[model samples]
Structure formats: C-alpha cells, structure tokens
Target chain A: MGEFELIRNFFAAAPCAQGGEGVALGIGDDCALLAIPTGEQLAISTDTLVAGVHFADPCDPFLLGQRSLAVAVSDLAAMGATPIAFTLALTLPTVTTDWLQAYARGLSLMAQSCRVALVGGDTTRGPLSMTMTVFGRVPNGLALTRSGAQPGDLLCVGGELGNGAGALPLVLGERTAEPAIADPLLAHYWSPQPQLALGQALRGKATAALDISDGLLADCGHIALASKVAVQVECDRLPLSSALVAFLGKAGAQNAALSGGDDYVLAFTLPSVELPPLLAEGWPIHVVGRIVAGQGVTLLDSDGQDITPQTRGYQHFRESP
Target chain B: MGEFELIRNFFAAAPCAQGGEGVALGIGDDCALLAIPTGEQLAISTDTLVAGVHFADPCDPFLLGQRSLAVAVSDLAAMGATPIAFTLALTLPTVTTDWLQAYARGLSLMAQSCRVALVGGDTTRGPLSMTMTVFGRVPNGLALTRSGAQPGDLLCVGGELGNGAGALPLVLGERTAEPAIADPLLAHYWSPQPQLALGQALRGKATAALDISDGLLADCGHIALASKVAVQVECDRLPLSSALVAFLGKAGAQNAALSGGDDYVLAFTLPSVELPPLLAEGWPIHVVGRIVAGQGVTLLDSDGQDITPQTRGYQHFRESP
Candidate 1:
C-alpha cells in the first residue's frame, strides 16, 4: 500500500477513532477540528521517542506503540487534563504491513485504555521514531501546575517507583527473571499507566502535580524549582513494588526508587490535612516526603540525616553509562 | 549545558514566545495550556520533514527551519484556521550551538511572521528531522474541507502555482540563474508564504479548499475523490509567476504549474455565484478550472482539446525522478 493508504487503513481505522469525544473531524482533512468547551482550556503535550535512543532497537512494535502514546499522555494527566484526543507523527525507514498492523494494534489498545481519540497524524519515511501530541480539557482555575506547591504540604506519589528503571537490565537482555517478576517490570517499561484519575482528583486540592518520567529525584527538582520551595524526600519511605525488590534486593530497589525513570506515576504535594480524604478513598497515594520553605530537593534518611546520592537522575545528552 | 538549558536558551527564548497570544502557558511545563474563544474550535495539523528526504542534508539550517514550519502552517491556512500556537518535536544528530541558534532563529522568524506562538516542544538527539504540530482557531462549522465542492463550481487558486517546482533545479544544485531571477525562485523554495489571509477569507465562501503541496493535478484528484465531482482545468489559465516563466520559459513553466510540487498555494472550488465578492474584494483569486458532474481531474488545451498529462504529482515512497 502507498503511505497514504497505510495511514488510512491502519491508523485512521485504529480503535482510537472508532468512536471518541471532542473529535469534530478526523483523518483525510487538512486539519482535524476539535471542539473545546466554552470555559475550559485545552491542555497540550508532545513527546518523541526514537529507536535505540528511547527504546531498544528491534523492540516489539506493539509495545513500542503502546509505550509511545502512554508516555505522551502522561503529561496530560500531570496537568489534570481529561484525555480527549491525540495525533501521531510516525517516521519509518520502510513500511512493513506486519509491523504496521502490530504497532497499530498496540496503539489502538492504549488509545482505547486512555479513551484518547486519534484525530490526525502525518507519516513519513525516515529513521524509526514516533512523536505524539495529546490534547485534553481542564476547567479554568482548577488545573494543577508545578508552580503551586506550598510549604508544609505533604509530598505524595500515586504508586510504586523505580520498577521501569529496575527492569532496565532485563529489557537490555543483560538479565532475565521469571515471568512473575518480569511481567510487571516489562509492563512498567512498555505500558506504564498514566495516572489520569489521580491527577484529576488532585486538581484544586493538590498544590502541585506532575507525572514522573525522569526519575523521582530529578523530577522533584523540577517541582522544587518551579514552586520555589524545597522538597525533602525520605529515602526510607519510597514505595518500591514487591516485584522490584524481589529482582533487585532492598538497597538496589531503594536506589531504583530514588533514581529510576519512566514510572509514569503522579507525584505531587498537598496540605497535610488533605491527604487522608484521598487515602480514605483507596487511591494508592504514598506519602514519601514533605514540602519545605527552601529551594531544591533534598534526600533524607530514616534518621532524618541527609543521604543524597553522589549522582542525580538521567539527563539527556549526557554520555550514556 | 544540560538538555533543559539548551532548550530554554535556544527554543524557549526565541522571538516567537516574546509576548505571543492565546497561550496561557508556553514552554517549561508538563503541558502547554491554551485558551480558545467561546464559539471557536481548535484546528490541528502535523507535518514531519526528514533530512535527505523532504529536504537536502547539509542545507542551510536557517532556511530549513523557516520552510519546515511554514509548510505545516499552510495546512492550517487551508482549513481557514487562524494562527494560534504550535508544538515542535525536534530531533537532532548532536548538540551544536551554531546550528541550534540558526535553526531557532529561522523558526522564530516564521512563527513571528505567522503570528503563531511556540507553546510546547521536545528536543532529543537522533537523525536530523522535525515534526511540527500546529494548532489554530476556527469559528465552529465555518472551516473549509475538501468534501464540500459541488458541480458547476469554479476552481480557483491563490497566487502563482509553479515557483517552488520551478526552483527545484536550483534546490538540487542542478542549475543556476542570475540573482535577480534565482532569488525569488529560491525564496519560493525556501520560504513560501502560506496563503493564510486568502484561506481565512474563503472559509464560508469556498465550497472546498486545500493548500497545494503535491502538484496541482494530484491534489485536484484528492478534491474530486472527496467531493465526488470532476474537475476540468484549462491549461492556458494556469497562473505562472513572472520569475517562474523567466526561469523555465512558457511551455516548461506551464508544465511546472500543472505538475510541479511544494507551491503551498491555496486551491479551492466555489459556486459561480460566490466568486464575485471575493474577486471584487481584490483577493488574488485566479480561476483555473471548473467542476463538472463526473470523477477525476481532466486537463484541456487552449483549443479546448483534452490534453491530460501521462504522469501525476509527487507521492511519498514513489521512486524519485
């Protein structure tokens, strides 16, 4: 099939466009028209993942598709934006019908899971990479932002941390584990769920919120800098998944939780008194630290002693280890 | 410098962001927030241009930057969408301050000219390529689409048609011309202005509209398929810029006007009754053809004899000439 037919047959017919809200017009148009509610503002996010850079070369097309959209959608969740639609800019060296089908299936699965409509996209021949831009809606004055954190607020995360980072060795084939341990970690790497509901719930309640893509420590530094306050993380309190601790012992697991990336979990701060209500509702909110009247992020031990590591989290353009 | 610093100093500080409108939040956020007027809908379009495929490798980064964004914004114009904001997903081979500076300068210039704000983007190291997703605003239900054309409508185009295609020889370094002739052709190749105003004016007036990127004949086929009407083009009526004619001569310029690509000129159809006001208002509406009750596009010679070309316009993945 021609490039146009490939996109039309696979992407346009993907589950994301079968039936979704806010997509006034989909593919085969000069532009996709989207309806935004009168008083609501549109939340937009973009992410690009390149082969052998973001994921392993020769990775599963389905998993790659799922991971690509999931990570991009994470930013929408970070802003308390309800999933509405997305556009895919896919560059491939060549078109393989088998690969396209599998990839579209994975993308369709995630788009269905997130309830995000695939409204528009462009496909071109190039090195394998996917750039997805997601759109969502948020009511005015209620949207969460990184600059709203306040002193005396409690720091929290949506769920376990470092699983994706912990899964790195297995992902690269440097190590292997039983399916029991591998499945969860692989899912973390390939299909980490974006905390959309938690972010929506925290809106107007949490002072600040963001999805953790670049390890907890580095991402916390972002909140700190933007909010103009210090975030003290109690290393002892980091929530590590049992699967992660089983694979990488206690200290290793803690290290992963402290510095691992691509968890796609919600991290935020709210008044101390505001935590109980969210907890009582059975939202997997883990209290990991607190916001303080200072700048930057500080790591503290169980005994309240500073135990910051020698290195921070991942930074792009740095030489790979 | 760190990756964040590179983006902050280069892209975020570009002139496009210095007091642009409709962007509630620009770069440096998990997602950019945008506000739309109560009765308007968001028009979204994405285009990805790859090195050595869409443009030449080792070309002027400044020109590439300007042309890349200008072409994508052309789709917004084709939809009659007003300038709003855009997100850029830029992939580079390595971090070079010189290239980044020039590229950003060109992008900023185009963004400023179009009055579009750079709301959000991501930067990463990879093969040199750019994927730009632009957002614009359109009054609800007033946007133009390719499916609205009807029989007996006059086919019109905005401005000259073949300058870019006529300039291809210079772009590939296969031919050279005097500066007086070459400069304008190169400008058409490197920085063709999107017909934004004409497109906006044609919103409700034109039955169907689109910007011509692929040659006129192929793109016209698209309108015929979508609108289910036959289009008859009068070869003698094709608009050719003076610079194009000077470079390629009469017959060659007409051929280029009929089948050359990358013009970014608006091609649309409207009922005979709707043409007067737009033409009377001094819009650069060049009537090139008329719609009939059939399928596909037909070319007629000056003597009114059928003279359709054997080949159509450019198609991605098709073998290069």
Candidate 2:
C-alpha cells in the first residue's frame, strides 16, 4: 500500500458520536466537516509541542498523545466551548507501528472521554512534533473572555495546581519515583482532564476565565491586564494536593502552585455569591482572592503583608533551549 | 501590553469577512467559532514550512506568507471544497516589526483572495516555522476522493507543471535571476494559484483529484495506488511554459517538470468526452495519459515507446536534512 492508503487504514477510522450534533465527516479527506447547532459558534485553537521542547524525548508516546490533545482542548474549556473535533499534525523520524499504536490509544481514550472525534491531520518525516488544532462549539457571544472580569469579581480556580509541575522532576528521573509522589504527578502530567463542564457552566456566571497552562500568578496577571483591574491573590488560600504538600513541603508546594506550569485547570472570576451546585461539587473550587478597580497583580500573605514572586511560570521567550 | 494583546493587535488589523455562512465568530477570542452548514461536511488539511526547509531562510517574508497559505489551501481545492477559514501557528526567534508586517500582508492577501478568514493560532519563540490548518466546506457525500479513480479515465492536469521546482536554483541564488526565466518560475513558486475553482468545477465530473505539490509523476502514482488502477503518461504531451523552455534546454526542462516539487496545481482524471476550456485560454491543461485496469504508472515517449523517468520528485523520507 502507498502512503495515502496506509494513512487511511490507520488514522482514517470513522469518527463515532452518539447523536447530539456530531462530526459530519471525519478523516479520509482534505478537511473534516462538522455541523454546529444554530445557536452555537465553533471554537478553534492550535498548539504545537516539539519533542525535547514540550516533553522529554524518551517519554511514553501514549502520555505525549494524551497531553498534546488535552492541552489544545484546554483552550476550548477556557472559552467555555464544548469539544467537538480535532486535527493532529505529527512529524516523526519514521513510522513505527508500535509507537503509533500506543500514541493512538492514548489519543483515542481522551477523545472518547470528551466526545471529541479525530477529524484529520498530516504526517510527515521530520523531528518529532505534534500540532493539534481543536474545535469546539459555544453559544453566540456567550464564550468567556479574559477581559470580562469586573472589579468586585471573586478570583477562583477549579482544581489543585502545581502537581503537574511539581511532578515534573520525577517524570524526568531527576527525583526518585515514589508512589506517593509519582502516581498523582504522572496522572496530572500525562492525562490532564480539561474542565469543559465547569467552563460551560461558567458561561455567563464567571466575569473572566482562562486556563492555567502557565503558572497561576502569570495566568491571573493576564486577566488583570486584559480586564484592566487589580488582582490580589491570597497565597495562603492557594489550592494544593495532599500528595503535593507531602512531597514538596507546604512552602515549596505553594511555590509550585504559584509558579509552576502545565496545570490545565480553569481559573475564573465570579461574583462572591454562592456558585451553582453543579460547579461547586466534585471539582475543587478555591477562592484565592478578589479583583479590585486598578491594574496589575499583587500577592498577599495571611498577615496582609505583600509577597513578591521569586519566579514566574514558563515564558516562551526567556526559556532556554 | 501583554502577549494576548500583542496577538490581538497583530491579527485584528487584517481584513476579514464578517458573519458569513460558516463563520460564527472571527478573531479576538481563545478560539474562532464556525457554524457549519447543516447538510454540508467540512474538509481540513495542514502543511508546515520551516525556515531553511521549505523555503530559504532569507526568502521574502511576503512570498513565504503567500506560499504557505497557498500550499495548505491547495489541499482543500484538491478535495473539491470551498475555502472557509485557516489557523496559522508561527514560531519566531524574535519579533521583528518589518518581517511581521510583510508576512501579514502576504497572508492577508491570499486570505482575502480565497475569502478565508484568519482564525485563532499560537505563537511561540523557537526556530522559525509555520503550520497552517485550512478549512473548507463540501456538500455531504459529494467531495472528491483520491481513491475514486477507475480504469479507462483520462489523466489531466490543471496548469503548467515544474516551474516552481525549476526556479529553485535561482531562488537559492545558486543561479542568477533572469526575467525571461525567473519571473514565471518565481511567480509559480511564490504565489501558487490553487485550482479551487477548477476543483469545485470537477466535483461530480471527475473520478479522482489531487494537487501536484510533489510533482506530476509522483502524485499521479498516488492516485493510481489509491484507486488500484494503472496510469500512463504521454511524454510529448506534457505541459511546458515558454519561459521554462527559454531558460532550460528541452531535456533539462522536461526533467525539472517531471521531478520538481511545490507546484500547487490540480491533477485530476475525467471521462474524455470534452476537455475544460483551461487550455484554450492558455491555462495549461494537458491530457498527458490514461488510466487502465491495473497498477503503477507507465510513461510513453514521442514515438509511443515505453520510457523510464530519469528523476522522481522529492520524497520526505529520502530527502537529506
């Protein structure tokens, strides 16, 4: 079989959906097509993760596949869009059946969880890299934006942070992999759960919303600048997993929560009133601080003393190759 | 003020058609939204061009912009779909205002030409590379397929082939630029006129269709294998431009035409009742060969003797980095 036929056999398996506005056509074409509902708008985002840049070279292909799709789909969550379909661009040194199978397995698992269908993509011979372009649907003009936060809005996060970054050392073999530290960290890094339901629930309730791909402090700063408001993050109230606190001390865990990256949790601002039961249950919702009618972000200690951040999250420009 | 704002300003200035049939929302959001027509399916394709890989590092930013979009859009054309929107992932070493402006200009020009709007895409600080994911719409179950060609069909091409590959030496400065030879070749490379119109015109009429990005012989082989048929090309009937002939001798031009890449013209097979008016207006439609009930490609010389191709097009696995 030629390249095209081989691709069709392996990657062009038909997209599956159980009713509710699914993919109209998936794979085996120049582009996949979807049919969005009348009141919905398609949400789209693209992200590229290069081997040795985004993830370690020897990392499991399955984990890479899951993380790659999760990261792109997280953008949809930030926009309060419902996941629909995605396209993957994979550049590899060569076609290895074993590697492809493992990678496809991971990708299919996450896709099945989110009801996201693999639509189409290209495969080429190059340095290992994966670029996923994800598509979602949101009600017209209801999608959350970073500029929507008001001065009195409460700063909130949907889940624990820093576990992904705190677990990185173990994943890289720099630190010994203990079950207490490795399992959660590996889970956080390998298979991040995009908070699509939480985002959709926050459609009109949250004043501003964004995903914490970078550190909490840096991503919150995005809200501050975009909304032209001041943000006070109470460091003591920062959410941390029990595993994280035990592995890295309380202070170290706090540092990771504040400055670590790769936690695809929803960071949003809402009114101080009680949130919907749907959003408050199962998901960990922490009230870190509140927005003020000013600009820039400020961190506060339990005693109301100003605290300076020693490091910010990953900066594409400043990070060393 | 921040990365998000920077992206907003950079892309918002480009012209975009607002509130079309498929586009639910344009730019300035985490993801652009599209509402696919109810009965139609979407076609998608992605292509990546790296600096010093797809084009010269010092190549014109405008031409790079044009060619990058053109190459991706050509895939949609090959599928007999209508262009809708695209996302661009640009990784740059540094932000150069002049370079960005020129690149945006070229990108906007092509986007406008095809009426496809620029949607959401990511930007990163890394080696210069561009990945474009293009979207198009086609009627349900009506899109052309590479695997649809059958025996007894006529193999045809939309326009002149190999000018882009022939111009490579000049573009790399390995040879001096001569207008008689340089202009057409460069134009063909820089601003490829994707056969969208021709492709749309061939929807139900043609058996199989694809763009000639790799080269006539190589891409035709793709169709043959996909459709499980044999393809034969008439050497003397191959399309040639006067400029190509003037620059390179007959044999030299033939070799380039047969083996060169990056010519995003359409090659399709149709019944041989009446040819399209592409040739009468000098747009370069050549009936090079025919398909038979077998496998692989065969070439015939001027005297109808079987001729072997001296060169084959670029192969991703075989090319040296």
Candidate 3:
C-alpha cells in the first residue's frame, strides 16, 4: 500500500471506527453498511467547517475535531433520532502526524459521547476543512420537525444558551479572563454537547424542534416560518451561563443569547402541559418564550413590548434580499 | 432571514432536493430523514474533491458538480446498493450566482441520472471544495464487499478503463485530439456512469467487488489484501476503449489502465461459473485475470511473466513506512 493509505489505516484503527450497534460494516470498504431497525427512518445531516472561515486557522486541532462532530450530531438531536454513525471527509493543506493523532483522539471522544461510530470517510489534500455527515434512526412518524408547532405551544431551550457566542472573543484571542469565567465558555465553544437524550425525550412532547446554530431569534424564525405561527421570545427569560454572564455582563450576555450563533442547543416548541412531565423527568427543559397567532418571530421586553433588533444573528453570506 | 441563507434556498429549490422515494424529509430541516426498507441495509460513502488537487481550480463548475456526485455514488454502486439520496457539503471561496446556478444544474442532472435525491447539505464560504455523501439500500447479507474473493475466482472489470487518465492531458490543455477521441475521454473523466446495475447483478455471485478509483493494479492489491488472495492481471487481456487507444496509443493506454487512477469502473472477482450468464445478459463483463492462492497483485505479460510496476496509483500523502 502507498504511504497515503496509511493515513486511512490510522483512522481505521481509531476506537470510534470500530463496528458498533447498527453498523453492519465499518471502514475499509467502498461503502460502509448500516442496519436500520424495522420501521425506523434514518436521519442524516451534513455540516462543513472551513479553516479561517469557521474557526481561526491556528486553532487547536483537537478542539476543532471535537467541535466539528459535535455540531453535526446536534442536528440528529434536533431530529430526535438515536445516534448511529458518521462519516467525515477531511481535507488538509498538508499532512502532519501530530495534528492527525490529536484530531483523531478528539473525534473519538466526541463519537463516544454522542454514541455514534465512525463508519467511513475520505481524506484528501487541500485547504484545511472537514465535512461531517451524521446518521441516526428514529421511529417512523416520531422524528421531530420544525413544521409541527401550534399557536399556543411554549418555546423552550434544552439548557444554557450564548456560551458559544460569548466564548468567541476568547477563542480569537481578543480577550482573556479568570479561569473560572473562561473555562466554561471555552469548553462550550470547543465541545458543545449534543442534547441527544433531551431531544429523544422531547420527541413526542415537542410540537416543533431544532438545534440553535443560527442565534435564538433567527432559529425561532425558522420554526415560525415552517409552522406558520408567530414566535414570541421573552428576552428576560433567556438562559445565560454563569461563565458567559461573568465574561460579557448582563446586557452583552443577553445580546449574545439573542443574536449569537453556534450554541448547538436544542430549541423547540412544546405544549404547555407537556413541560411539567418532562421537567419532572429531569430533562433540561427551560422555557424561553411562546408561540403566538401572528407570523414571524418577535422579541418582547419584560413589559411585553416589542424590542426586536434588526440583526438577529450571524450570517456568513450577504446575498441579495 | 439573512441574505446568506438564500444560498440554501437556491439549493432547496433545486429539482433534486425535492422529496422522493425513501426520502421522508428533504431540505429545510435540521436533518433529512430517509426511510430504509425493512430487511435492507443502508450503504453510505463520502468523497471530497478539492480544487487544484482533484481537478483544475478554474475548470468548469458544472462539470465539477457532476463529477463530484458521480464519483461518490460509485461507491454505493460498488456495494450493490440501490440509489436513495445524497447530501452535499460545499465550501466556496465566494458566492457567485452564475457559478451556483450552473453547478446546481450539473448536480441536478447527475442526481436525476443516478435517481438519488439531494436530501440536505451545508454551504459555507472557504477555499473551493465539495464533499458528497451518498446513501443507498441493499438487502441484508447480499451487499457486495471487497473481502469475499477466493482462490480460483475470475478477476473481471465491468468495461473499458483508463479513459479518465487518458483525458488528463486534454483537460490540462496540454494536448488536443479529434472530437471522436477527445469527446469520449473527456466524458469519461467528467461524467463517469457508475455501474450500479452490474453491481446488483453481481450480488451473491461476485465474491469481491470494488470500483476502480486507484487504477486496476493498486485497487486489485486492496482486494488481495482484504481477501487474502493474490490477483493476477493479464496485461494482454486489459480492456481499453478505442478512444483511449487513439489518444494515448496501445502501450500508453495499457499503462494507464494498469497504473492511472480515477477510472471509476467496477472490478470484481467472480467464480468462473457465474460469468457466462451475466455476459449473456449483456453485462460488459471482461475477464482480465484470475485470483490465486498467494499475496499481493501481479501483472503478467502475454507469456505469463511477472511485470509489476513500482508506483501503483495516486496517493495524497507520503507517510513513513
């Protein structure tokens, strides 16, 4: 075999690439085989992170590896699907064994945390980037979708929000703080846990669901658009992590919670009655707002007055509108 | 919504993104849901192509779109799986409406040709590259694999090879030829038709199968290593298209067939008893060699003398042995 094929061997030897439940066959094949249970639908999502575009070029490869898989797996959580397997197509300007080993370790850790196996992937030389396609399975008619929310449903988030956004300054090396403040924020930035169990818990209870990648207001707008109902965000109720609040202060943290992206937290609309049972079951269900009769999404002040901002979240492109 | 999300809308409106058979949900969701049939396994593969490495940077985006998806689907074909759907993770240096339209059109055409839906994808700004992940379904215990070859099996290729390699000079603007030769070679390079039907036909018959992306010899070595049997390729029996021979001469075309990469043709090991019926049914089964009780791959002259070349095929990295 050529030297390049050895890189593939390195990945093949990774713990996560070994066959796991639902994986009929893993790496070393032209195609990996996944066995889906009868009556289950496969959930698939693809996410790409480009060096310099998605993260700093010199950022930690280990963190990059963890973040990449975590973000992709979050989509499965949004869909309320059980994590199955994932394939990564990685491109790099050059091969560095040190970088690869560290990256693979991070990937393996995330795969274990998310309960997903590394099934197959392609490795190539180019500008550094990676695309992860995650697969999951959910029973037919049970996978969560954004189009099912009703007018009276309460909107909720899985847990704390804004930490990823609050951590950006630190990640770009523009700011530094006490370890107590920076640690949690940086951890959220580099290793956002996909709320898979919470998503599955919300499957039958949630009227509509999605993971918060594009800030809270913008992602809520997606649900409003898809469900044909207005969403009201209670700005006062927005969840902010302690580290985020310490770093950005109340107003900045609140703004980050409202308009920041990359949170990777589940946001969903649920019937008010469904909340108590799930909350009692210990799911991290945090009420953030409600669905109303109007169209589009609106942010409301404590007095319930309209206080929406023009720029709701981060946008990578500026296409003609 | 931000202008950048419109790029997603552009793809969402493409013909291939519409829900099709086995697609429970298509675009505009956190995850696309695919319904896997009972008693069938899902086959998946990912392939990435980077500008300047896999193809010319300034080459036609339309052709790039087609070639990118086609090559990825070839892996499903190698697994004897029925086409279902695919996701695209596209990274671009910048957004160009004209480029996006042409590229989407090309991708749509290829998707239709392969009968696979564009279920979902991610579009981001970065150095130009794309990763395609294709999903297909095959019956349990029936999918073809690369580790099933046994001694006394006939080594075969689905059709003519080396056209992709022979067209490289023309693609790079270093050579010119008549339309009869150049047209076919360029077509092979830009739009290889995955032999899905042939692969399905070989199910339970061909002991081992894989698409030839790493040339005949190198890929044969993969089969030999996996199946623990040596593959003998009779150089005199190598199949070459008239166009390839016309462009590169017989010896050059033979060399390309042996050592050049990106052919995207299926090579398989089938018991000698199974070939006649398939050939009778009009499958382009070409007997190139045979499997023997040994290790590695061997290239033999007309007189049956060993003549293996040193460098087998393309490799992106050179790691220490």
Candidate 4:
C-alpha cells in the first residue's frame, strides 16, 4: 500500500477515528471537522520529538510512540482540558511494516488510555521523527494557566518526581538496576502519564498550574515570571519516588528530582486551606513549597537555609550538542 | 536566549500572535486556548515539509517558511473554513538568527494574508523539518468534504493548475525561464495562495471538494473513492496559465497538470445547473469535466476518447529516495 493508504488503514482505522465526542467528521478529509460545544474553548498544542535528540534513535518503536504522545498530551493535561483529537505528522527513513505496526500499536494504546482520537495526519519520507498536534476542550474561562499564582498560596505536585531523570543512566546504557528500581524508573521514562484527572480536579481551585517537563525548578520559574510571584521550594520536601531514590541515592536523587528533565508531573499552586480536602480525599497532592510576594524562585533546605538553585533545567538551544 | 525564549520573542512577537479573533490565549502558555463561535465547528489539518525531500536544503528560508504555512492552510481553504490559528513545529540542525528572522518574516506575511494566527509551537534541535498544524472554523454541516459527489455533477476547478508542477524543472536547476514565465511559476511553487474565498462560496453549493495538492487526476481519484462516483477529465478543457505554457510548452504543461503534484488549487463537483450564477459572479470557477456512473477516474481528449491515467501523483513511499 502507498503511504497515504498506510495512514488511512492503520492510524485512521483506530477506534477513536470511528467518530467520538466533538469529532463531526474524522479521517479521509482535507481537514477533520470538530464540533465545539457552546460555552467551551479548544486548547491546542504542538510538540515535535526527534530521534537521537528527544530519545535514542534505535529505541523500541512501541516505547517511542508511547513517549511521543505522552509528552504532547501532558500539555493538555496542564491546561485541564479533556482530550478530544490529535494529528500525527510522521516522517520515517524507510517503510518497514513491522516498525509502523508497532508504532501504531503504541499510539493506539495511548490514545485509548488518554481518551484522545486520531483525527487526521500525514506520513512522509524523511528521517525518523513525529510531530503531534493535540486538541482538547475546556469550559470558557476555566482553563488552568501558569499566570494565576498568588502570594501565600501553597505549591504542590500531583505525583512523585525524579523517576524520568533517574532512568537516564539505564536509558543511556551506563547503569543497571534491580527490577524493583528498574521497572518504575523505565516506566516513568517511557510512559509518563499526564495527570489529567488532577488537572481537572484543580480547575478553579489551583491558582496556577503547569506540567513538569523541563524539571520542577525551570517550569516553576515559568509560573513565577508569568504570575509575577516568588516561589520557595523546600529541598527536603520534594516528593521523589522510592524507585528513583533506590536507583540514584539520596543527594543524587534530590538533584535529579529538582533539576533533571522529562518528568510529566503537575506542579500547581493553591490556597494552603484548599490542600486538606484534596489530601483528605486521597489525592496525591504533595506540598513542596509556597508562593511568596517577591519574584524569582528560592530553594530552601529543611532547616530553612537559603540554598537557592545553582543549576537550571534543559533548554534546547542553550545546551551543547 | 533559550529555545523557548527564541520562539516567544521571534515567532510569538508576530502581529497575528497578539489576541486575534477566536484566540483567547496564544503563545507563552502550555497550550493555546481558542473559542469557536456558538454555531461553528473547528477544522484542523497538519502538513510537514522536510529539507532535501520536500525542498532543496539551501533554498531561501523565507520562501520555505511561506510555502510551509501556505500548503497547510490550503487544506483549511478546501474545507471551507475561515482561518483561525496555526502552530509551527520547527526542527533545525543549527541556530542562525538571520535565517530565523527571514523565515519568521515569510511566515508572518502568509499568516497575515490568510488571516491565521500563531498560537503555540515547539522548537527542537534535529534534522531540518517543519510541521504546521492549522485550525479554522466553519458552520455546522457546511464543510466541503470529498464524499458527496453523484452522477452528472459538473466537475470544476477554482483556479489555474499546472503552474506549481511546471516549476519543478526550474526549481531543481534543470531549466531556466525568462522573468515573465519564471516569476509566476516560482510564486506558484513557493507561495500559492489558498482559495479561501472560493471555498467559502462553494460551501453549501458544491457537493464535494478538496484542494488539488496531489495533482488533478490523483486528487480526483480521492473524490471517486470517497464519494463512490466516477470522474471524467477532458484534457483540452484544463485551465492552464500562460506562464506555464510559456515555460513548459502546451503538451508538457498538460502532462504536468495531469500527473505532477503540489498544485494547491481546489477541485469540486456541482450540478451543471448551479454553475451559471457562480460564473456570472466572476469567481474564477472553470468547468473541466463531469461525474459519471462508474467508479475511478477517466481522462479524455478533445475527441471524447477515453485515455485513463497511467501515472499517479507524488506518493512519498512510492518515490525513489
């Protein structure tokens, strides 16, 4: 079959493409038609992941596919929008049915899990890469943004941190770990789930929010600049996974959790009073810091010593290749 | 500045990125928030252009930028949707300030011309490729899809074709032309205007439609398969521009129009009875063929003799790398 037919038969034939909520017309069209309901808004994001840059070139096709969609969907999760549809622009060096099938399986698996539909896409001939543009919906004026943090608000994270970064040693073939440590760390690196539920639960409750992609410190700095408030992150209070601690050790794990990249956890700010109900209801909200009146971010020791961050997270252009 | 800062300052600083219609929030966020009108449905499409495969690597970045956005927006035009916003995913091997400034200028020019805004995007270091996902809005049940044709419907085109295909020889340095012929062909190649207005006029009138990116005959095959109707194209009636004929001669231009790709024109089917009024309004609609009873497409000469196609348009996988 031709490339277009490959896209039609494989990617477009998935369950989500058969017509789901908001998708008026799915594949086999110039553009996918989506009906946005009244009193709602569409949240859109685009992310490109390149082989050998974003991940290893010869990595498992299934894992690559899963990681690709997961990273892009995390943006929507940060916006507190319900998943709707996504378009995949895939470029491959060669047409290998095995690779395509595995990739499609991984993409389909993630689509089903996230409740996202494959609306439309184009397949091309080039180096290995994928660019995913996802669309979701949120009620008007209710989407969470990184520009609403206020002084005296509590800063919390939805899940454990440093797992993705802790997997780097194993991912690059520099280290080995026991299954107890390896399983969770590798899972976090390959398939970090977007906390869509937590984002929705925070809707108007959290004053500011964003997914932790570029590490906790860098992304929280985004909140600080946009919300124009200072943030104090307690080094002792970070919620590191047990697997990560076991894999990287205490001080190393602490550094990775605060400064390492690719953690898709949610870091948000809300009133100190609002945390109890969510915590009481068994949400995974771990309070790590608080918003202050000034600007910039300050890292503190357990003893309240001023041990501000000396290192920054990954910035694509600034780093040497 | 970092990659994110580069995007925010260079691309996000474009006029279109600043609070245009339907865009509630634009760049500098996890996701761009857009509000489709009460009765409108969202139309989405994505297209990727890679250096060396889609275009020459050393080609003008400015023209590449213009062509990239134009190609994706053409799909929106074909869907009869008004352009709203677009997200650009750019993967580059190196950082060149001058190249980015020129490219952004070209992108901003087309975004302004097409009335589309820059919403959100991600920039990364990798092979040179750009993926643009565009969004637009159309009234419910009014999108012009490629699935509604019937027998006896008059097949027409919105504007002249073959110019883009006819430009390939010159684009690849295989041939050269005088200014009068070369300029139009080059423009058609680098920056063909999307027929947004023509598509809007055809909304409820035309039965089925799509932009002719994959040349006429192959795109006609798309309508045939989707709508389950036969299409017949008369070679003598194709609307070719003087510039194409001057560059490639009559026979060569006709072959290019029939078999070559990258012509961003609209092809549609409407009843012969509905043509007069649209024509009288001077909308540039040219009748070229008719829908027939059987399936697939048949190419005919002025003598009304059948000469079905032996060539297909550009399919990435089918092409020899």
Per-residue alpha-carbon lDDT of candidate 2 for residues B131-237, written as tens digits (9 for 90 to 100):
89998888877787888888888999887877988888888988865687799898888999888888888888788988988778888878888789999888788
lDDT of 3 by residue, A1-321 (tens): 343465566688888897789999999889999999998899999999888878999888889889999999999999999999999899887777788888999999999998899998989878899999999999999999999999899999998989999999999999999999999999999999999999898878898999999899999998999999999999999988888888899999999998898999999999999988888988888898999897999999999999999975777664431
Candidate 1 per-residue lDDT, tens place, B150-185, comes to: 998999999898999999899989999999889999
TM-score of 1: 0.98
TM-score of chain A of each: 0.98, 0.94, 0.97, 0.97
Interface RMSD of each: 0.8, 2.8, 2.0, 0.9
Error in Å for residue B144 of model 1: 0.6
- Ordering by TM-score: 4, 1, 3, 2
Of 1 and 4, which scores higher on DockQ?
A: 4
Superposed by TM-score, candidate 3 places the C-alpha of residue B291 at a distance from the truth, in angstroms, of 0.2
Per-residue lDDT over B78-163 for candidate 3, one digit per residue giving the tens place of the 0 to 100 score:
99999999998888877778888889999999999999999888888788899999999999999999999999999999999899
Which DockQ value does candidate 4 get? 0.88
What clash pairs does model 1 have? none
**For model 1, what is the C-alpha lDDT against the true structure?**
0.90
lDDT by residue for model 4 (A1-321), tens: 577788877787766566678889888899998988899899999999998888887989988888899999999999999989999999998888899888888887888889988999889989999999999999999999999999999999998888888998898888998999999899999988989888888887999999998889998899999999999999999988888887788998988988888999999999988989998888899999999999988999989999976777878887675
Q: Write the per-residue lDDT of candidate 1 for residues A1-321, one digit (tens) a residue.
A: 466677888888887777579888988888998999988999999999988888888999999889999999999999999999999999998888899999999998999999999998999888999899999999987778999999999999999999999998998999999999999999899998999998899888999999998889999998999999999999999999899999999999988887878889999999989888888998999999999999988899999999888666876666672
